[model samples]
Target chain A: AQRVTQPEKLLSVFKGAPVELKCNYSYSGSPELFWYVQYSRQRLQLLLRHISRESIKGFTADLNKGETSFHLKKPFAQEEDSAMYYCALSMIGDMRFGAGTRLTVKP
Target chain B: DAGVTQSPTHLIKTRGQQVTLRCSPISGHKSVSWYQQVLGQGPQFIFQYYEKEERGRGNFPDRFSARQFPNYSSELNVNALLLGDSALYLCASSSPGTGEKPQYFGPGTRLLVL
Candidate 1:
């Protein structure tokens, strides 16, 4: 079974400070990893996918196969960046999501 | 284009009752997936339907069932609802040939079971 793990339940960062949301997955086969964000009172949106390697909203994640981790990072954090982030892993036909991390970009 | 949309933004049901939630995928999207998100938890996959056929299903009870229509719209039916079933039901749509690569999620239907 593929499992997504997000070690941080809550993370707070000062404005203009760097932020990193750690994510780890356990899967024997190659899996597609993704990061999704849900803002307050808004629908969940795709932040980025490892395969695309596109940077969105100043956030970037690098898939490390050896470590089985895909950590989302941003050089500078803004208040609007605060939201609930979820790491998801898709393998074959099944998709699994992590517990989620509440990111708070404090002013 | 219109993103994925779900019906009955909010629903309340009691134990032993049955409820059905509807989802309309984005125009031209051919796959629909259902998920359950409890308070403070991430969404859990329930079912995935593509081209009117079930492509995948998560670890859920038989009480939870869903089907995609010819139009690619879908409905999720829950029988004998339990308190644990009270959660936000999310419907996601993926483009054709994408399988589950990247899914566009709807606002979600909030179901409350008593």
Candidate 2:
């Protein structure tokens, strides 16, 4: 079975500090990864996808096939970056999402 | 354009009761998916419908079922509800294509089973 794992349940960092939300997956075939964000009281939205290979909202994720990881990282975190981050894997018909990591960027 | 929309923002029901949740996809979207999200956890896939056909289904029991309409709108029905079924039910829509495309989500319906 395909599975996504987000090791960190909660992360806190000061503003302007670098942050990385680790995500690892277990899949036998080629995997499509994505990052979704849910801000406070807002609907969940797509942040970025590995296939796009484009950074969004100053966040980028690289699909490391060898490591089976697609960790989301940002050089400088902002207060607005505080949200719940979820790593998801696209399957044949269904999609699998990680448990999610909650990041709090303190001012 | 309007995003995915779900009806009945919140619902409360007693055990063994049945409930139905409605969802309308975006204007041009042909695929609609349903998910169940418990507090502090990721959303779990329940069903996916495309062009009014059942494309995918998760490990949910038969009590949980869903169908799509000709217009691509969808409805999720749960029978003999259990306390564990209380959670945020989310609806997502995407273009008729591969799973790589991002699926836009709705605000979700909060369900509580008493």
As a whole number from 0 to 100, the lDDT of residue A81 in candidate 2 is 99
DockQ of each: 0.76, 0.79
Provide the overall lDDT of each model, using Cα atoms, as 2-decimal numbers. 0.94, 0.94
Candidate 1 CAPRI-style tier: medium
Q: DockQ for the candidate 2 complex? A: 0.79
Q: What are the clashing pairs of model 1? A: none
Chain A TM-scores in order = 0.98, 0.99
C-alpha RMSD for every candidate? 0.8, 0.8
TM-scores for all candidates: the values are: 0.98, 0.98
Best by DockQ: 2
Mind sharing the TM-score for model 2?
A: 0.98
Error of 1 at B98 (Å): 3.9
Instruction: Chain B TM-score per candidate, please.
Output: 0.98, 0.96
lDDT of 1 by residue, A1-107 (tens): 57899999999999999999999999998879999999999999999999999999999999999999999999999999999999999865578999999999999
